[model samples]
Target: MKINMLAAGLLLIGVSLAAVNMYYYLEGTLSIQQVKMDSPLPVKVTEASSDKQWPLYDVKPSVGEKFAELYIPRLEQVFPIYEGTGTEVLRTGVGHYIRSALPGEENHTILSGHRDTVFRGLRHLKEDDELVVTTPEGAFTYKIYRIRIVTADDHSVMAPKPRATLTLTTCYPFYFLGNAPERYIISAKLINKQRVITWNPSR
Candidate 1:
């Protein structure tokens, strides 16, 4: 009986700690500095012989893992982005399309967030607006060029482009209370990138 009481106490302590962290995150205090890197992660993740190159990501991420943070300076908002599109992942933060290229890749990278939560402020974005994606590997900057509405079945949202592209999707009718049939896409392309330096000669 004593062992059971100790176990319960430990569990409560763990839960309380987690709650405190989340409180700071949602308050934008802790999340603001969670990801530190050089802004605009370098593009061209893959090797290229003569300019035509494949997209590559410096960081290798696992499914449903929190790998980066998405920051919108215009909105003064920051949110976490996980590596997979799991339902729970979306509930907690944005989700990266597993099949899409990672940040800094010279191709399309797709991202989705729930309109009611993480992406509620996305609709305010406009052309020429800038956003940043910060990962342990590096940081990427993109300038918004296109914002439109499409049917949820639209595959173009995931299409790769000749240049570096970033696509953010959220359900349409931002005020809707439930599953939305339409999609709102905000497409941007890489303007600058910085690669994370992993080598340490001093070590």
Candidate 2:
């Protein structure tokens, strides 16, 4: 009986180990697939052509809550805007700085992104660089005013301003060799305004 019990226990242990291994393997595979699915599309938007707009892939902004159309002239890219700040959404496009509040509705409209990929190209900006954001109602232009560095834990950087404003964040040391400890911030202010256009008035 002891010999038989010993064999059974060993067999159960082997099965348990195999199950755990399989669980981990499947978990890793799913994580990779999520990241792959999150990858941004390669479409680019340039110019204010009435004939073209970014393919939003079924993104819908809430009614009474307007959406901003972001344009980085330097990159010749135009992307849609969403409310409530988050890297997950901003990394994909222009994300509203959750800490700052919504655009037009508030005094400041703060947006942030990953420095390495989404906002990586921002480092190329200089003082007075122009950033234009058009809403479904109107367009608000911003001028780059300054660049600064702050630590990762500095959430206060997204504080609201008394006047119309825009802020962009990314990692510091544009050419650093290792993980960046400081965050790079770009500030801007509203300039020109334009009316937002929609192809489907029925929607």
TM-scores, all models, native as reference? 0.70, 0.59
Model 1: per-residue Cα lDDT over 1-203, one tens digit each: 99999999999999999997576446433233322344432222322223334225545799888877777877766677889988767767889999888887777889998776678788889999988876655567899999999998888778778888999999998887557989999999888765545411110
Highest-TM-score candidate: 1
lDDT for position 83 in model 2: 68
Note the Cα lDDT for every prediction shown: 0.74, 0.60
lDDT of 2 by residue, 1-203 (tens): 99999999999999999997566444322221111323432222233434223222244454223266556776655555556454345434556754464444336777765554556678788899888665554455789988888997798777778777888887787667567888999888766443445421111
Evaluated against the true structure, the overall lDDT of model 1 is 0.74
Best by lDDT: 1
Worst 10-residue stretch by lDDT in candidate 1? Answer: 40-49
| CA deviation > 4 Å runs, candidate 2 | 1-66, 175-179, 197-203
